[model samples]
Target: MSKKVAVLVAGSWGTALASVLAANQLDVIMWTRGEDQATEINNKHTNQRFLPDAELSPRIQATTDMAKAVEGASAVLIVAPSSAMRSVAHQLKAHYKPEMLIIHATKGFETESLNRMSTVISEELECEEGRVVVLSGPSHAEEVVKRCPTTVVVASLDKASAEAAQGLFMNAYFRVYTNRDMIGVELAGAFKNIIALGAGMSDGLNFGDNAKAALLTRGLAEITRIGVEMGANPLTFSGLAGIGDLVVTATSQHSRNWRAGSLLGKGQKLDDVLNSMGMVVEGIRTTQAAHFISQKYGVQMPIADQLYHVLFQERQPRDAVEALMGRDPKTEMEVMTLETWEQWHS
Candidate 1:
C-alpha cells in the first residue's frame, strides 16, 4: 500500500507539491474549499485556475472534506496563504494526530499576532513547535509543476522531523536539504519577500542592473541584520532560504510580491496595485509586521522600514529610495560583532 499524504488547499503551490508526492507513489489528497475545484481535480485531474497547463497525476485526488483529507494520512502539508494559516490550522486541529508529521510551506507572518506559521500551527494542533517542519527556498510552484529541477530546505529543531520531511519531498527533479536552523530558515524565507519588493520597485522605476544589484546586496544586508537580531543564525541569511529565495522572488516574473512592487513603483495606488493582482501579496503584509518587529527588537531595518512607508503611509517609492540613500554612513561590517564572524575569516 502506498503512503498517504494530505495537502491542505489546492493553491498553485499546494497543487504542485501534491503532484510531487503523487509522483513519489504516495497517495495524495488535496483539500480545497471550493467543491467545484475538488470535482475538477478529482475527475479531470486538472486545476486550471492555478496550474493552468499542468496535468495532475491520477494518484492525486481532491476533497472538500477536511476531516476526510486528514483521516489516516501519515503527513499533512499546509500551504494556505499566511492570512489563512491560523484559521486553517484551527480546522486541522480537529483531525490532527500526534503521529502525523506536520509540514508548512507558507511564508509570511500573522500580522496581528506576529507569529510564525509553525508557531500558529503548533498552538492550534497542541504540538511542540519543533515538530513542525518548514519547507522553503527558491522553488517556484510554476516550475515545480513542470517537473523542472528545484531545490528547497526543510528545517526543524527536531532532527527526525526535518529528516522525515526531507525524505518525503526529495525526488529526482526535486532536491531537499535538511537544516537545523528553523528560526533562520523561517525568518529568511519571510524577510526576503520585503527585498524582492524592493528589487521590483527598482526595476519598475527603470533603474538598471547596477541599481538593482546594489538594492539586492544592501537589501540582503538589512534583512540579515534584523533576522540575526530576531535570534536567527546570521549564516542562514547567506544560504538557500536567504540569498537563494531572495534572488528568485526579486527577479522572477512569477513572484506576486515582485509584481506588486513593480506596480507600486510605477506610481499605482496601494489599493489599485493590490486589486490588479488576484493573489495575496505576502510581502506587503510582511512589511507591516516587520515594521513593528524591527521597532520591538530594536533592529535597524532600513529597507523594510522604507517599504512600510511606501506601502502604508502613501510615501512615494522614489522618495523612499532617496531616504534609504541618505541614511547615515556606517561601517559595512557592522552586521555583527567581531567575535561572531571572526571564526569564518580565521
Candidate 2:
C-alpha cells in the first residue's frame, strides 16, 4: 500500500511537491484554498494559474476540503506562503491527528510576529516541537517539477521528524539531507531571499558578475552572523540552506526575489514592482521582518537593514549600495571568531 500524504496549498511549490510525491507513487492529495483550482486539478490535472505546462500525475488528487485533505493522511506538508501559514495551521489544528507527521516547505519569517514557519506551525497546531519539520534549500518549484537535479535539507529539533521528512521526499533527482539545526536552517532559508534581492539589484544596475559575486559572498556572511547570534549552528549557514540556496536564488532567472529586486534597482516603487510580478515575492515581506528582528535582536544585519530602507523609506538603490560600500572595514571572520568589541585586530 502506498503511503498517504496531504500537501496543503496549490501554488507552484505546492503543486510541484505533490507531483513529486505522486511520482514516488504516494497517495497524494493537494489541498487548495480555492474551489476553482481544486476543480481544475481534479478534472484536468492542471493548475492553470501556476504550472500550466506541467501535467499532474494520475495518482494525485486535488480538493478544496480541508477535512478530507488532513483526515487519514500519514503526513501533511504545508506549502503556503509564510503570510498564510498561521491561518492554515489554525484551520487544520482541530483535525490534525497526533500520529500524523507535519512538515513545512514554506520559508520566510512572519512580519507581524517575526516567527519562523516551523514555530508558527508548532504553536498553532499545539503539536510538540518534535512533530514539526522544515524542508528548504535551493529547490525551485519549476525545476523540481521538471525533475531537474535539486538538493534540499529537512530539519527539526526532533531527529525522527527530520528523518521521516527526508524519507518522504528523497528520490533520484530530488535528494534530501537531514539536519538537526532547525533554527539555522529556517533562518538561512528565510534570510537568503533578502540577499538575493540585493544580488538582483546589483544585476539591474548592470554590475558585472564580480559585483554580484561580492554581494553573494558578503550576504552569506551577514546571514551567518545573525543566525549564529540567534543560537543557530554557524555551519548550517555554510551548507545547502545557506550558501547553496543563496547561489541558486541569487543567480537564477527563475527567482521571484531576484526579479523583484531587479525592478527595485531599476527604480520601480515597491508597490509597482509587486503589482507587476503577479506572484508573491517572498523577499519583500521577509526584508521587513528580518529588519525588525535584527533591530530587536541587535544582530548586525546591514544587508537586510538597507533592503528595508529601500523598500519602505524610499531610499535610492544606488545610495543604499554606496552606503554599504562605505561602511567600516572589518575582517571577514570578525563575526564568527571575534570575542569582544574592544578586541583590536585588523
Candidate 3:
C-alpha cells in the first residue's frame, strides 16, 4: 500500500505540501475545519481560495473529520498558523500515534510563552521533543504548488526522524535537507519574517535597494545573535533557514509579512493594514514576541526594536526609519559578542 500522510489543514502552505507528498506517490489526506473547503478539494481537486492556479493530485484527499484524516497514516504534517497550533495539536492528540512521524511547517513563536512551534507541538502532543520535526526554509506556498524548484530543511534532535521527514517530502522539484539545529532553524524561520516586514516598509517608503540590502544584512546579524543566545547553532543562520529564507521573505511579493509592512510604510493604520491583509501576518505577532524576547535575553535588536515601536507604539514609519539611522555609531560586527566570535572562530 502507498504510504499515507495526513496534513492538518488546507491552507496554502499545507495544500502545497500535500501536493508534494502526493507527487511522491503518497496518499495524502488533508483535514480542514470548513466543510465547504473540504468538499471543494474532494470534488474539484483544487483549493481555489489558497491555491488558485494549480490542479491538485488525485492522490490527495480532504476531510473535515480529524480522526478520518489521521487514521492509519504514516506521517502527519501540521501547518496551522502559529496562533492555532496548540488547539490543533490538542485536537490531534486523541488520534496521533506514537510511532507516526510528526512534522510541522508553521513559523512563529507562541505569543504568550514565546515557544517555538516544535516545542509547542511536543508539549501538546505529549511526545518527546525530538519526535517533533520542523520543516522550514525559503519555499513559498504559491510557488511550491506549481512544482517550482524549492529547497527546505527538516530539523530534529533525532537524526532518524529528520531523515524520515526528508524522505517523505523529497522529490525532483522539492528538495529537503536534514539539520539537527531545530532551535536555530525554527528561530531563523520566525525571526526572518520581522525583517521581511521591515524590508517591505523600506520599499513602500520609496527607499531603494540599497536600504533593503542593508536591512537584510543587519537583520541577519541580530537574528543570529539572538538565536545563538537561545542555544542555536550560529552556523545555522547562514544556511537555508537563515540568509536564504530571509532573502526570499524580505523581497518576495508573495510574502504576507512584506505586504503588511508595505502598507504600514505607505501610512496605513495598524488596524486598517491588518484588516486589508485578509491573512495572518506572522511578523506582527512575532514582533510583539521579539520585543519581549529581546528584553528577556538582554540582546540589542535595534531593527526589531524599531519595528516593535512602529507596530505597537504607533510610531510613524519614516520616523522609525530615522530613529534606526540616527542610532549611536558602532562597528558593524558589534552585534556579535566576543564569546560568539570565539565560538565561531575557535
Candidate 4:
C-alpha cells in the first residue's frame, strides 16, 4: 500500500500541498468543512474557488468527515487558517493518533493567547510540542500547484520527524529542507507577512525601490531582533524562512498580505480592504498579534508599530510612512545588544 497522508481543510495552500503529495504517489485524503467543496474535489478534481486554473490529480481524494480523513493515515497535515486552527485541531482530537506525524503549514499566531500554530496544535492534540512540525517558506499556493520550482523548510524539535516530513514532501519541483530551530522558523514565517504588508503599502504609496528596499532590510533586522529575544536561533532568520520568505512575500503580486497592504496604501479602509480580499490576509491579524507581542516583550518594532497604527488607528498610510522616516537617527547595526551577541556566539 502507498503511504497515506491526511490534509486538513481545503484551502488553496492545502489543496496545492495535496497535489504535491499525489505527485509523490501517496494516498492523500483532504478534509473540508463544506460538503460542496468536497463533492467538487471528489468529482471534478478541481478546487475552482482556490486554484481556478489548476486541475487536481485523480489520486487525491476529498471528504467532509475529519475522522474518515485521518483514519489509518501515516501523517496528518493541518492547513487550516490561523484564526480557525484551534477549532480545527480540536475537531481532529477524537481521530488523531499519537504516533501520526503531525505537521502544520499554517502561518500566523493565535491572537488571543499569542501562541504559535505549533503550540496551538500541541495544546489541542495533547501531544508533545516537539513532535509537531512546521512547513513554511516563500512558496505560494498558486505557483506550487502549477509545479513551479519551489523550496520550503520543515522545522521541528524532533530531528527524525523533520526528516520524515522532508522525505514525504520533497520532489522534483518542490524542494524541502530540515531545520531544528522550530521556534526561529515559525517566528520568521509569521513575522515576514507584516513586512510584506509594509512593502505593499510602500509600493501603493508610489515609493520607489529605495523605500521598499529599506523596508525589507530594516524589516528583517527588527524581525531577527524579536526572534532572537524569543529564544530563536539568530542564524535561522537569514535562511529560507527568514530573508527568503520576506523577499517573496514583500515583492510578489501573489501575496495576499501585499495586496491588502496596497489597498491600504491607496487609502482604502481596513474593513473595506479585508472585505475585498475574500481570503484570510494573515498579515492583518498577525499585525495585531505583533502589536501585543512587541509590547509584552518590550521589543522595538518601528515598522510593525506603524502598520498597526495604519491598519487599526486610522493613521493615514502616508503619515505612517512619514513617522517611520522621521524617527530619530540611529545606527543600523545595533539590532542586537552585546549580551545577545555573546549568548549567540558563545
TM-score of 4: 0.99
Screening candidate 3 with a backbone cut-off below 3 angstroms (N, C-alpha, C), the clashing residue pairs are none
Candidate 4, residues 131-219: lDDT per residue as tens digits? 99999998999999999999999999999999999999999999999999999999999999999999999999999999999999999
Quick one: ranking by lDDT, best first? 4, 3, 1, 2
Candidate 2 global TM-score: 0.96
lDDT of 3 by residue, 70-180 (tens): 999999999999999999999999998899999999989999999999889999889998878999999999999989999999999999999999999999999999999
Where is model 1 poorest over a 10-residue stretch in terms of lDDT? 337-346
In model 4, which residue pairs have backbone atoms overlapping below 3 Å?
Answer: none
* Cα lDDT computed for each candidate against the true fold: 0.91, 0.88, 0.93, 0.94
Give the CA lDDT, 0 to 100, for residue 10 in model 4: 92
Q: How many residue pairs clash in all the candidates, one count each? A: 0, 0, 0, 0
Local error of candidate 1 at residue 310 (angstroms): 0.5
User: How well does candidate 2 score on lDDT at residue 183?
Assistant: 93
Model 2 lDDT tens row, 64-145: 8889987789999999988999999998998898888899888798899998888888899888865689898988889898
Full-model lDDT, candidate 4: 0.94
